[model samples]
Target: MNTTMNEVYVILSTYNGERFLSEQLESILAQQSVSIRLYIRDDGSSDGTRAILASFAQSHAHIDVEYGDNIGVINSFFALLRKVPPDAEFVAFADQDDIWLPDKLIRAVDRLKDASKPVMYCSCYKAVDENGDFLWQSLPPEKEISFKNAIVQNITTGCTVVMNGSLLTALKIHQVNTKNLIMHDWWVYLVAVCFGQVIYDREPSMLYRQHGGNVVGAKNGFALWLGRIKRFFLYRKKNSRIAQAREFLERYKSDLSTEDSYLISAFLAYRQAGLLKRIRYAIEMPLYMQKKSDNLILKLQLILNSVH
Candidate 1:
């Protein structure tokens, strides 16, 4: 790729991440084959995070830091996204505690360079502990990435996501209401699948740290299954996937294709319908999660009207 074409903007949100902030910044700076401008927004860190960020900013010309109130992760990321330069052709999301590989940005840019429309690239990641010990490698999605699947489940990991300029433009145009938003990455996946393209890379791009302070971490085996069940039952009203879907449809219905709009409308309608209709919709709608067991759980949730 041409040197000028390889420029990328990376946005990161930090919150009391002093323990691994410097290491993460060093890894981002070490990225190869791409010219990077790192924009970091500290979400009101009370720890040494602001001091560490100041030191980096004072020393590095390409790094810019913004210390702001704690508006939560979703809004903080969106704020950083708005700060990205308009001329930027590619943008990637970063976590304050992960160790990015040298080729992470380059690999994502290579995949996204030729896209003409809105497109997103996301890769698998290696889960590690706070001490950087290997935990496990995330598996690739067994099914196709589609709006139907995205409406129900998020397979995209934020730190590994990269997007073309077109998608960023679309996101800016259709601003999201963070009230019911799930995660920044999941929202991006939903938009890309509905309006453009989604590329899921099987290659591991970074060391995803599974530490106590992590906002979200990878879980596997029975632990993962049990956690999902707990969230579905215990936190249904607060973290409803149905509410997220409803928000997406409400905001983008006009721009959505006929089939896509109909699918979402039907999905929302069935949930609000009577018991028999809800059961039929649960069995009939083509929407699904990545895993078979998870898909079954989704159907059960729909049948019982527990998604709300």
Candidate 2:
């Protein structure tokens, strides 16, 4: 592939990330084999993040900064996605503090270059500490990547995600409800599986920094598992996976295939079904997370109608 012909617009949303922001920006700038235009939106940082971004934007013609109010991460990313130029051939999301590998953009572009329809490419990551020391590498998804799995679990890490022009165009067609989303990347994965294709690469693409300020860190051990258990028991109704799926169905019901439409409708119906029906749905639905243990928890959540 001619790397010069592939222009990738990377959208990054930052909040109080001044400490490692410069390093992240430099790594992105040093990406090999592709033309990159970095677009950043600072989510009302009280630190030196704005000044740092301003300095970089002033020095680099390809870097653009938007000093915006604090709209949270999901909305901030969605805002940046909306601002992506229509002529852009590819789009990728970036984190404020993670050091992207030199081959990140090129790898994504290579995977998506042949796609003529809506398609997204995402990969695993090597988790690192605040000082960029290796922690652990995230495991690739063991099960199939499909709408059923996406409805229940998100395997796509936002920083490793890249979308073709067709996928971006499909996403822009809908007025997305950021309030109903769990994460921008999760929603994108769901959409890609439902309406297009998702390519999952097992290779590590970046250094996923895990620190005190991480909104969502890499899942690797017992602590994360315990936290997930707690969250499952205390899950809120308005922001649960069911709510996200409901919002997705409402927006794209007419465009969904018959099987997909029924799957979502049945998933939603579990919230109001009786004990027997809920149990039956739990046993019958093909929804699953990546791990068997997590799949068990998901089934329990379904049987108890705890997803809502």
Candidate 3:
């Protein structure tokens, strides 16, 4: 494959992101070793975000824009995915606030160069404040990225993701209920692990800016950690992950491998299973979060449900 000739469509979903949008776009435009095009969707922004998009699209021949209703982040991303050009050889998800490194797209394309089927590449990034000052680096990959982990948690963040055209085509075909997916990237990871491949790169590639504007951002430190514990306890009864997993299973049951099918079945059934049954399944389920501490907390949440 000619890396230089590959047409990559970078999809960006925006709301009120006029502040950092230009910087993010500039970084993306600086990528080397591939032909890049910017495709943006404005999710009913009331700010100057549309004006910024309009200005960029008018000056940049490769930039395209779409404006739609504010149907929520997950759906907005899915809507963007649906409109990706049929001939696009690769697709990368972009955030409105983060600044990507120069090599981000090139590295992802190179990693996925020899893939013969649907595949994905996602890398780590530096967590920064709204002003782009460093806060911390994203946690290194502590566990294998698998279908099991994808079912419980979304480690494949959209901003860090670059996927092949085949994966894009397949996703557009088997499109799950976007509303049911906790996130678009998670659904992409699930499909890749079940049918193709997913590569998790530990190298930092972007400045993941943390501001109140992020749909989801890095939450490090004691207060954020404590708030998570409180939120989990408060809303444990309505676990969204479990609901998303259930929806995934029902929609794509025929496509999953026999082993994955069984694992998902066991995971979904854990809530209703007897104590001994739940324990055995939980022990066998090889799911994990990015950190060991997070894994321990997940174990606690599981126990609470089982013994309640």
Q: For each candidate, give its TM-score against the true structure.
A: 0.97, 0.97, 0.92
**CA lDDT, every prediction?**
0.90, 0.89, 0.82
Give one digit per residue, the lDDT tens place, for model 1 in 233-265: 776545467788989998888899999998888
Best-to-worst ranking by lDDT: 1, 2, 3
Which regions of candidate 3 deviate over 4 angstroms?
1-4, 236-239, 306-308
Clashing residue pairs in all predictions, respectively, total 0, 0, 0
Give model 1's clash tally. 0
| Candidate 2 lDDT tens digits, 1-308 | 64345789999999999999999999999999899889999999999999999999999999989999999999999999999987678999999889999999999999899888889999999999989999998888898899989888888889899999998888888898888888999999988988899998898999999898998877667978877877787656447788899999999999999999998898888898999998998888888888888888888988877774
Name the TM-score of candidate 1.
0.97
Quote the positional error of residue 294 for candidate 3 in Å: 3.0
Residue 227, model 1: lDDT of 88
lDDT for each residue of candidate 3 in 161-200, tens digit (9 for 90 to 100): 9999888877877657665667788888888887799988
Worst 10 residues of 2 by lDDT: 231-240
